[model samples]
Structures are given as structure tokens and as C-alpha cells.
Target chain A: MKFGILVNEGPYTHEASDTAYQFTKAALEKGHEIVRVFFYHDGVNNGTRLTTPPQDERNIVKRWGELADQHKLDMVVCVAAAQRRGIVDTDEAKRHGKDADNIAPGFHISGLGQLIDAGIKADRLVVFGD
Target chain B: MLHTVNKSPFERNTLESCLRHAKKGSAVLLIEDGVYGALKGTTVSGKVSEAMKSVTVYALQPDIEARGVQNRVLDGIKLVDYGGFVDLVTEHNATQSWL
Candidate 1:
């Protein structure tokens, strides 16, 4: 089955990110295909590489980066949400006249159309949020 | 359809509203604070039990454990781990999260 995951919350503050990560990992382990992972609302924070979690804590952003790398996942952060939360990719940074890009590896900033496309293409659309 | 609710029934009406919109044969998976609705003998359990007549119900085991409600879950609610969560999504045609 092909799945599309929608995450609507940020890391650490909520369990949504953790649960989404676990579900995504389990889906891949079970040999299911993940069509896309769409980050919206506060979830765009997960795409930023600037987070500095405590040494003892799990780096949720880095964990997502690793997972995306291993699976070659399509991790998309909503452009509107990212702009509101300051999660800028190289193009967005340049467009917005920002000094640098903060988007993490294996993630891209895209429009909400990607989310609509995921819904249309994937067999299931699973959402994780508050 | 698989309708997932992650809010506490006491704190939010997500579970109640989800039940209202769930079609016959749809499944409801309670996670996070939403697991509270699956607790046996709770006021909300009555409604959940009623909804069970037309829909299958599930609760995430880890979330129940985290909230210290493992022993209180109602009998009919199936418990699932993260892998089971994936299975549920696969079994269903689509998922709608009541966030």
C-alpha cells in the first residue's frame, strides 16, 4: 500500500512528531511504500536544521533527516507554514532576502499543492497531530 | 476509513465529533489522550461503546501505557503498537485524523 503522512505539530512540544516517525518507520519496515510526508502548520519546524536539542534528548529533526536519507522519502514542508515559522530552504532564503538557509537535508520546502497531490496519489493519508 | 483521534476526550470533543462523522464500517483508533475514551466505566466509554456497534475501535498500547491507563481499557478495544498502527492504515482505504 502507498501511504501519505501528514504531520501538523512540531517536535518535542508534542508527541505527534514522534508518533509520525514511528509510524513511518514501521510502514517502511513492513515493506509498504510511503508516497510522501507532508509537514504543515507547526510541523514545518521539523524541516529546520537549526534546532539544538539537549545532548541527552533525541534530535527529532536529525532523526527525520536520517530516515528520509535511508528511504529516499519525499519529505515536504509547506511553503506557507515554513514561511510563517522561518523554515527557509536555499531558494526561499534567497527569495526572502535571508542570510542563510535553515532547511534540513532530505526535506524540501514546497507549496500546499504537494499535500493535495499526496492525497490524490497515495492509497492512505495518515495524519499525526495534537 | 480510519479516523484517528489524539486528543483527550475530557479536554476536547474530538472523539465525540469523530464518532458523529464516522461512517458504518469505519474504524476509530485512539492515541495520545484520546485513549482516555477507551477506559472502562468512564462516562465517555458509554458513547464509545455505542459507537462500537457500527465501527471497530482500537487504542495505541504505548499511548495507553504512557498515560497509565493500561489496566483500565474497555474489553472490546483492540490494542496496537506502532507496527499495528501501520497495519491498520494499510487495512483501511483512507485515514482522517481528528486533530
Candidate 2:
């Protein structure tokens, strides 16, 4: 089955985002296809390159990047959420008059329509939140 | 149908909102912090059960395991792994996630 994941919480606050990550990996291991991962609200924090967890903690940002790299996942962060959180790619950073771009590779900043598209395109839209 | 709720009962009527419109043969999946509501013998659990019946109720194994509530999960509620989680969505015609 093809799956679309909607993650709406930050990585550290709760296990929602992290659990989504683990679930994504497990889905791939089970030979299921992941159509896309859409990050909204605080979930967009997963796309920030500046995040650094403590040594004893899980580096959720890095883990997400690694998962994307290994699985060739399309990681999409909501543009509204990203802009509100000050996470932007090079073009968005330039447009917003920011000096630096913090959105990591393998992740793109897009609108909510992308999420709707994923929901319509994929066979399933699984969500992790709060 | 697949129903998802990540908000707590104390905050709002999340369970009601999540399941009130559920279709037949659907399941409710509690994830993230929402697993806290799956604890047996709680008012929250009772309310969840009361609001919806017959349909399967599930909580993420990892979330419940992380919170040390695996043993406390209600009898009728099933625990779902990630693969099973994917199956729930595939079985349903539509999915709704309530925050």
C-alpha cells in the first residue's frame, strides 16, 4: 500500500514526530511504499538544519534527514508553518530578506495543497500529531 | 474509515470530535500523547468507549510502550504496530486526524 504521513508536532515535545519516523522506517522495511511526508504546524521543525539535540538525546532532525536520504522520501514542510517558524530554503530566505537558509536538504517548503494532493494521490494518509 | 486523535480529553472533546462522524468498519487510532487516554479504568477510557462501540479502537504500541502503559491498555482496545497502522488506513476509504 502507498502511504502518506502527516506529522503535526515537534520532535522533542512528544513522541509523535519521532514515532512517525520509526513508523516510516518500519513501513519501508515491510515493503510498503511511502508516497510523501507532510510536516505542518510545529512538525515543520523536522526540516530545520539548525536543530541539534543534546548528546544523550535523539538527534531527531538528523534522523529525519538520514531517513529521507536512505529511503528517497519526499519530505515536505508547510510553507506557512516554515515561514512562521523562520525556517526557509535559499529562495524563501532571500524573499523574506533573511541572511541564512535553515531548511535541510531532501525537504521542501510548500503549501497545504501539497498535503491535500498527497491525501488524494496516496492510498492512505496516516497522521502523527500532538 | 480511520479516525485519529492526538489531543487529550482534559483539553476538549477530542474523542467525540474524532469518532462522532466515523463510518462503519472504521477504527480509532490514538497516537503520540493521545495514548495517555488509553489507560484502563480511566474516565477518559470510559468516555472513549462510550462514545464509540463495535468499531475497533487502537493505540500505537511504541507510544504506549514509551509511556509504560502497554500493560494498562484496555481489554477491548488493540495495540497496533507501524505495519498494522498502515493497514488501518488502507482498509478505510478516508482518514481523519484530530488535533
Candidate 3:
């Protein structure tokens, strides 16, 4: 089955990100297709490169990037939510005159239409939220 | 359809509201604080029990364990892992997240 994943909460502080990650990984392992992983609301915090955790702790931001790389996942952070939360890619940083970009690998800032499109294209839309 | 509730029944009426709209034969998944609704006894467990007559209720194992409520989970509410969560979504045609 094909799946559209919607994550609406931040990492570490909320369990939504962890659960979404686990679900996506399990789906892929089961030979299911992922249409897209859309991060909205505080979920965009999962895309920021600036996130760092203690050495023994699991780095949620980097973990998502690694998962995306291994699966070639289309991980999209909502532009409106990202902008509101200060999660910026290089282009967004340049467009907004920010000093630097903080978007992690495998994540692109996009509009909510991507989410709606995922809903239409994927067989199921699985939401992990607060 | 599958309905997911991620808020505590004590904190919000999301679980109640989701159960109210959830049709018979539908699946309801409780995650995060929403696992609180699966407890055997609570102020709102009666509503959950009533809804379970028609709706099949499930709770995420990790969330329930994380909150230390696994021991107190009500009977008949199946516990599922992440893989099981994927299976639930695949089984249902649509999912409504009650955030």
C-alpha cells in the first residue's frame, strides 16, 4: 500500500515525530510506498539542521534525514509552518535575507498543497500529531 | 475509516469527539496522551467502553508504555506496535486524525 504521512508535532518534546518515523520505516520495510512525508505545525522542527542532542541521546533531526536518505523519501516541510518556526532552506534564507539556512538534508520546504496532493495520490493518509 | 486520537481524554474531548463521529466497524487508534482513554477506569472510560461496542479500539504500545499506563489499559482494546499501526492504516481506506 502507498501512504501519505502527516506529522504535526516537534521531535523529543512530542512523541508524534518518533511514532511517524517508526510507522514510515515499518511501512517501507513492508514494501509499501510512501507518497510523501509532510511536516506541518511544530513538526517542521524535525527538519532543522541546527538541532543537536547529547552524545548518548538520539538526534531526532538527523535521524529523519538519515531515514530519508536510506529510503529516498520525499520529506517536505510546510513552507508556512517552516517560515513561522524559522526553519529555512538556502533559497528561503536568501529570499528572506536570513544569514544562514538550517534545513536538514532530504527535506524541502513546500506548500500545504503537497499534503493535499499526497492525500489524493496515496492510498492512505496516516497522520501523527499532538 | 481509521480515527487516531493523540490527546488525553482528561485534557481534551478529542477522544470523545472522535468516537462520536467514528462509525460502526471503524477503527480508533489512541496514541501519545490519547492512551489515557484506554485505561480500565477513568472519568471517561465508560464512554470508551460504550464506543467499543461498535468501534474497534486500539492503543499504541509504545505510547502506553511510555506513559506507564500499559498495566492499566482496559480489556478488549488491542495494543499495537509501530508495524501494527502501519497495518491498521493499510486496512482502513482513510484516516481521520483527531488532534
Candidate 4:
């Protein structure tokens, strides 16, 4: 089955990121297809590479990056959310005159339409959030 | 449809609202703090039990374990791991997260 994930919370502060990661990993391990992961609301923070978690803590952002690399997953951060939270990729930074871009690898910034598209394309749309 | 609620029933109305609108035969999976609703003796458990008359109910094992409420979980609420979570999503046509 094809699945799409919608995460609506940021890392560390909420369990949504951890649960979403676990669910995505389990889906891939079970040989199910993941159509996309849409990060919206505070979830867009997961796409930022600038976070410095404590050494003993799980690097949620890096974990997502690794998962995306291994599965070639489509990880999209909602553009509006990212903008509100100051999570900018190079293109977005350039367009908005930001000095630096902090978007992590394997993730892209896109519009909310991608979320609707995921719902239309995937067999199921699973949401993880607060 | 599968409706997932991740908030503690005491702290939020997510579970109650989800149960209120959930279609008959729909599934509800509790994760994170949402597992609190599955605790056997709680007031929320009564509602969960009532909802069970019409819809299937489940809770994530890891979340229950994390919250240290495994022993308190109500009898009819099945516990699922992440893999089972995946299966539930596949088994249901769509998922609605009541955040």
C-alpha cells in the first residue's frame, strides 16, 4: 500500500516527530511504499539542519535525513510553515533575501498543494501531531 | 477510516470529539499521550468502551510502555507496535489525526 505522512509538530518538543519516524521506518521495513512526508505547522522545523541537540539525545533531524537517503523518500516542508518558522532552503533564502539557508539534506520546501496531492495519490494519509 | 488521537483525554477533547464523529466500524488508534484514554479505570476508559460498541479501538504499545501504563490498559483495546501501525493504515482507507 502507498502511504503519505503528515507531521504537524516540531522535533523534541512533541512526540509527533519520533512517532512519525518510527512509523515511516516500520512502513519501509514492511515493504510498503511511502508516497511523501509533508511537514506542516511547526513540523517544518524538522527540515532545518541548524539544530544542535545534546550528544545523548536523538538527532531527530539527522535521523530523518538518513531515512530519506536510504528510502529516497519525498520529504517536503510546507513553504508557508517554513517561512513562518524561518526554515529556509537556498532558493527560498535567495528569494526572500535571507543571509543563510538551513534546510537539511533530503528535504525540500514546497507549497501546501503537495499535501493535497499526497492525499490524492497515496492510498492512505496518516497524520502525526500533538 | 482510521482516526488517531495523540493527546491525553484529560488534557484535550480530541478523543471525545473523534469518537463523537467517527463513523461506525471506523478504527481509533491512540498514541503518545493518547494512550491515557485506554487506561482501565479512568473515566475516559468508559467512553472508550462505549465507543468500542461501534468502532474498533487500538493503542500503540511503545507509547503505552513509554507512559508506563501497559498494565492499566483496558482489555479490549489492542496494543500495536509501529509495524502494526503501518498495517492499520493499510487496512483502513484513510487516516484522520485528531490533534
Which scores better on DockQ, 1 or 4?
4
lDDT digits (tens) for residues B1-99 of candidate 1: 899999989999999999999999999999987889889988898999999999999999999999888999998999999999999888887788998
TM-score of candidate 2 versus the correct structure, residues matched by position: 0.88
lDDT of 4 by residue, B26-94 (tens): 999999999999898887778899999999999999999988888998989999999999998888877
Q: Model 3 segments beyond 4 Å from truth?
A: none
Local error of candidate 2 at residue B45 (angstroms): 4.0
Per-residue alpha-carbon lDDT of model 3 for A64-124, expressed as tens digits? 8998999899999999999999999999999999999999988999999999999999999
List A-chain TM-scores for all predictions: 0.98, 0.96, 0.98, 0.98
Clashes of 4: 0
lDDT of 1 by residue, A31-61 (tens): 9999999999999999888899999999999
Q: Write the per-residue lDDT of candidate 2 for residues A1-130, one digit (tens) a residue.
A: 8889999888788778877888888888888888999999999988888887789988898888888999999999999988998889999988979999998877999899999999888888877886
By descending TM-score, how would the candidates be arranged?
Answer: 4, 1, 3, 2
Candidates 2 and 3 compared by DockQ, better number? 3
Model 2, range B1-99, lDDT digits (tens) per residue?
A: 788877666667887677677665678898777787787777777776764575778888877887787888887788888788767777787778877
Residue B14, candidate 1: alpha-carbon lDDT: 97
DockQ-based ranking: 4, 1, 3, 2
lDDT of every predicted structure (CA atoms): 0.93, 0.83, 0.92, 0.93
DockQ of all candidates, in order? 0.85, 0.61, 0.82, 0.88
Interface CA RMSD, all predictions: 0.9, 1.8, 1.0, 0.7
